[model samples]
Target: MQPSPLAAPDASWYDIPGVRLVGAIAGALFLVAAIRAMFGRK
Candidate 1:
């Protein structure tokens, strides 16, 4: 059976270019923050 249009179970929002770009930026920011926190002080 085919899935209904309203039931898009395979919808990958992150696969979109805009979402990927935003996600990449967010990931980079979070990674920088984590690195700073890990070695910000002795």
Candidate 2:
């Protein structure tokens, strides 16, 4: 059976250029924050 419109699978990450780029930037920022929390200057 086919999925309903509201229940359809999401597009592949690379399919949306803008969202992909934004997600990458956000992920990088979070990674930097985590590293800083672990070893940041007091």
Candidate 3:
């Protein structure tokens, strides 16, 4: 049976270019923070 429209999952959010851009920026920031914390750098 097919799922109803309201019950279906929407993936349109990932289709936007800005979503990927923001995700990349956030990931980079997280990595930077993690590295800094690991080496005890301010």
Return the top candidate by lDDT.
1
- Candidate 2 C-alpha lDDT tens digits along 1-42: 878876538777678679888998999999999999999968
- Model 2 residue 35 lDDT? 98
Which has the higher TM-score value, candidate number 1 or candidate number 3?
3
Clashing pairs in 3: none
Question: Residue-wise lDDT of candidate 1 within 14-38, one digit each (tens)?
Answer: 7567998898899999999999999
lDDT of 3 by residue, 1-42 (tens): 988887537658678679989999999999999988999665
TM-score of candidate 1 on Cα atoms, chains taken together: 0.61
Window of ten residues with lowest summed lDDT in model 3: 7-16
**Better candidate number, 1 or 2, judged by TM-score:** 1
Which residue window of length 10 is worst by lDDT in model 1? 7-16
lDDT, candidate 3, equals 0.85
Q: Evaluate model 1: give its lDDT.
A: 0.87
Which residue pairs in candidate 1 have backbone atoms (N, alpha carbon, C) closer than 3 angstroms, thus clashing? none
Q: State each model's CA lDDT, in order.
A: 0.87, 0.85, 0.85
